[model samples]
Target: MNLTPNRKEHREMSTIVSRVRAAYARIEAVARPEIWIDLRPQAEVESEARAIADRVTAGEQLPLAGRLFAAKGNIDVHGLPTTAGCPSYAYEPEADAPVVARLRAAGAIVLGSTNLDQFATGLVGTRSPYGAVRNAHDPARISGGSSAGSAVAVALGIVDFALGTDTAGSGRVPAAFNGIVGLKPTRGLVPTAGVVPACASIDCVTVFARTLPEAEQALSFMASPSARDLPPLPQRAPGPWRIAVPPRDQLGELDEGWAEAYEAAVEQLRSAGAEIRTLDLTPFTEAAAMLYQGAFVAERYTAVGSFVDKAIADGAADLDATVTGIITRARDLPAHQLYTDQDHLTALRTQALSELADADALLLPTTPGHPTLAEVAADPLGANARLGRFTNSTNLFDLAAVAVPSGKVNGLPFGVMLIGPTFTDDRLARIARDLEPSVQLAVVGAHLTGQPLNPQLLSLGARLDRTTTTAPVYRLHALATTPPKPGLVHVGEGGAEIETEVWRLPAEGLGRLLAALPRPMTLGSVQLADGTSIPGFLCEPAALENAEDITTYGGWRPYLGS
Candidate 1:
């Protein structure tokens, strides 16, 4: 819980124990017991932290070293009972689920089980017997479920990240409500061998993190290598991205504040260099409806109908009433109806894929709006369905999605989800980065607008911010490389303001751009004429061995002309 770190820290062994102690203190201060179904003892978690430190000190490379995480009640964490949000059905798991085990192998410590909607049946956090999970932003509002506790824990900074399961937006809805990043990797990408099934065939193990990078980092370790022979992702050329959004008519009843926030998020996407297009939500809507309205709910019954039936027969009130009703009713869905629904879904998937074939990703409000605890209590079924407006069809259509908080509405968080075809997880990440804050980059040579390598910046979605110059404290050298390049070197005594084009790109893109850059060129702080420093291109002194000093020309373009 070293909140000061810009990124989730890779804790040094020396501070790992203290960090765990601090995390426990934060947990107590927050005082929201409903967030956890079974929190591990302080001494137990501390022991694991110390063990990780010891291993790290012994020359082990653990990417998630000393990171703390929680498993949704449905996902097995060794020694903790797998509840799937129904205490009556709790059973001791012999070992951690593969997803949890992978994280633990990489040095992430599991704190214990988090609360969720009983049997993972509802989108509202209220369906759990443990008590409603309050929104981290506002206690009066719902924290979203069936991953309620998982999302709230991450939002409250109680854990670095948590594992959640998504069948019908269970992972994403809560993320939007709690203002965190929910990453639903392609189905089968993260093994669900040990997770209690909500809808076994379509269930996806998801990650909830405070930021996109953190979520992406956690997913890297969780996802198995691609084994399916799926179609290759479309190769996008250098230019603005094509993003599809639902037309006004397709957007279900949205609160005014939420509608405005979503419109603003679309505008932000446009400003980030995306071409907005209208996508018909008919096919997606149809597919989503089949999950509950049609025979697909039978899949849920197939997963845990027996247990639910037994609980009801025993007159156990531990089962959520609404959840019980849904499962019991689905039990009677005729076998032929399931196939009929599947055939219908196949056609709808084809239609939806065709509609999205030309787009990079489909962007939608993560949910219609944030519902309060009272709203859900008032009409359990109606309120919960509204929250899945944009999230339900993803698994059915075999898509990957990432839900990210865009902004606030009525002092509550509003979020958007970027959905793409399976195996497009990486592409989705790049596109989602557009929604993040950008950094100013100063470019002096080939990367300048309209120059030989300018397309590189365009491909990475970098936009020209403005034309500017460095504070008269740099020397420009023309490096002798293929196509040639200019190197700007800061010289304290004798230098001139070098002509530079200030471009902006997301921090993630900047990292990628820097990594692919040719040798001898480095990205470092460049002092601007206004006495501000920003990341810009520089070079090693070795590159200047036989290069031309174009300092007199003041810039790359002018020197070339001369």
Candidate 2:
């Protein structure tokens, strides 16, 4: 998790490489060989590492210098086999996929090719012959796929980041389950040439990382206009922003834990000064239904149709029944129906575009809910379709998304996805990074400067806020609780200024801090003198019902010292 280097605290490139090498050694100690269909030899990886190190040492501003990452097996890595999770369908590529080549050019070392659900067909991680990928947080749970191994590799700290494909929820689902960040870029934003297509028109190369910053770093390196056959993307200006959230009716069978977590996440954003609004998701939901329920399934067949036909003719079909059935069904559709589906898709796109016009981004759950490996196996197709309820329309509508870890539900990770119109990738990443819980929580209580609790914040990647002040209307009360608790009360109209210090913590750290808080004290929105609000500590009304009002002393520290 401590993969990023401090921008101000410079270190030699060799040092970074050595740190990564040491981490990889640990991965090797518990190595699951089957999780990889093909791996770059140790010598080759080291050689690439050394070359990257040399470039960084020479003062080249390689944005991803000394970082190691992996690609899904379907993506062409020069000198490595492109198997698409099917050995019989394997072929040696003479060149790296355009996206991979770009990452390499930016100084990232390609560690190896990871496994996936066969041909990227299922959302569950068990369909691959290479092996079933286990959850990073809990081995018993499914890792979520077809980006299963890619998500696992990052969550387990095996690599700084990794690449996967997202036609459905292949990219975001895995990230959500594994507690990491998954970025499914706009179609054609990251070139897909040399990548085996699941549905070529919709397939997008995705990135996974432990944090949004790392994912954005990888994305910035990989996104570029292709020299050949790249489609056009929109250009928009940035300013006052509006974000759309799903109407309550569409939240979709969420568990209590997840519902609470999502609500808390939204409150956090509101506390950070973001204007949250509701949007009718009917258009998006309708378009998502068409991905598999309509003729778009035929696009997958069109991508691999000839290969499938030839393989079947040779008495060897290299496809899973579910995938074959989904693809073959497309053949039965008449040309007229296909055209009709396209026209319907066009209408949906128009409706979506109009709905999104007033907002800069759409916020929704990355997946409707999480399903265990056993649940997925019991009904593969149904469970997989459910996972894509929020994601299928993204690529089809030509939108980009960043799936960020919101928080945990009963110890299981959940995420919220931020979707935007094409070419807003940079803007979306910026907002997502800011919205992350850790970054927005302004610690001002026992965890302030030079206190015992300060180190806790530091350990969670918090930075000191130089300009700090307390709520002008608050009166501090010495609470009758453990850990020397304090209570803040709002004093209307006439109030005294209080002393407080603000410290910035990351999203992951904020969750830890909240979990550690004792009863009666909780995190809530605190308004400052200048009319700005941020996440801070507050006491339940019951806790302060009998407490004495001590507004005369100004703040807790002053009153406590007296």
Candidate 3:
């Protein structure tokens, strides 16, 4: 499921309804009941979409007019009951949570309410009485959770985007496992008033999308002014940014595949113009441990302990036993323990943030590795804890994070998270966008390595992916230009394979390159020798009328020597 941006437009009602129907068809095909605790009927959703379309036709500037989304059950949606992954605790909300309402006001329609770990307790998706939300990529593995269903919904393309909550990586872990983008904004940047709290003070309403821009777009509309007086954004000049990473020796026993993927991600970042710096993350890891292993566990109890206690007393509680133990055990903690832990955290947060003072963000593997359902079942606590080894600390320190896909490991998705200081949300987003899939562009002439105009591509941050040749169906012409430029034209009957180089650049850079291209040169699909086509340099037939035939020379470099 390649999740690309859905076109945001004032589309027709019929088109909107059709998209809704297609989504329903996809949902049926997926057959993952645990993903949704309460889904609106297809007809009902289509009807609302029609109304939204009507409003857009009336000249409403709804940015998300044609988009569809799902809300995590812990976040209130008007017609659905808030389950927080516990059926016995369900309750209907009077209106949508402020975050959901903002999205709806912008013309996005909600399809339903998705699942999560019960009480948002576990990092693994299995701690749900709604049944475990399986990974979108592989059912046998766990979908890293607390926000399990929301991430899976976006990954499966059932909806354009979905809402989730992140306290202890609920918003990030599932995205890494499912290959989607999770934007966890700085704490309190978005309101959590209507959400079922796990640790109310640090919990964030998160956005999950197939791409960073979409998640950023959602967050734009979702955010309201916060009382937290964040310092103005740093006045930094644009050039290569400094990015921090944990030293290789300190990364701690990563699965081989994940380690390789992390190293590749670092190189990718470096290629994208980041200066890599090694920093020990011992303090950061220690802060992450404090979230659950120390007095902070009491906050989770403070958030939902009474409800769980009451349910247990009534004998109507159908809860995950592990979640039960963690929350209940915190009930008797002395008040002084929280203050003591708070002091400890203040010291740790200061130390950890200082480590990133000179860097744009810290990049780390989102998790150690993918875990199988059986593996988690065999060692639930250890498996769940390990899943949060790289997450779980962001909000505790009031930081912002964006988790983006970083290739794959053993056919499963792997991802890396960029953590930045508080209020650096916009900055972090810009860096993360560069980490998304790069465009594969094939070039035949000037943009190739060691050519007159090659620097233009390099300036736009393009990296040569490979040097290959076109299928034996293209003719090469020496164009009459200020500087010698080659024109590639497809001639089915009498043509020769032409040398070409494929460069990978961020999608935004590709757009800029296309806009600045000269008239005689154009970009179109060029078939490679392997029978695959990618965007490559091409020319108008008219421009080649007075050009010299260079097919005999095979390539520009060879022709230059001749």
What does each candidate score in C-alpha RMSD?
A: 8.4, 10.1, 8.3
TM-score on alpha carbons, each prediction: 0.80, 0.76, 0.81
Q: Candidate 2 local accuracy as lDDT? A: 0.78
Tens digits of per-residue lDDT for model 1 on 1-562? 2233323234455478877887789899999999999989999988889889877766789988888899999999898899888888989989889999999999999888999998888898889889999999999999998999999999998888999999999889999988888999899888999999989999999999877777888899999966466767667767788999988879878887887888888999998789999889999987887788999898888889999898888998898889988999999989999888889999999999999977889999999888789999999999887788788999999999999888778778888999998888888888887786578899999999889999878755577999989999899998887667898898988999988899987665687688768889999999999999999999998889988998999899998898
Model 1 stretches with alpha carbons more than 4 Å out = 1-11, 234-239, 438-527, 531-562
**In candidate 2, what are the lDDT values of residues 127-148, reduced to their tens digit?**
7767778787777778888988
Sliding window of 10 residues with minimal summed lDDT for model 2: 1-10
Candidate 3's residue-wise lDDT over 95-207, tens digit each? Answer: 99999999999999899999888888888888988889999999999998899999999999899889999998989999999998899998988999789999888899999
Q: Which portions of model 2 miss their true places by more than 4 Å?
A: 1-17, 225-240, 313-318, 439-464, 468-562
RMSD of 1: 8.4
List the global CA lDDT of all models: 0.88, 0.78, 0.87
Cα distance off (Å), candidate 1, residue 356: 0.8
Clashing pairs in 2: 438-505, 438-506, 438-507
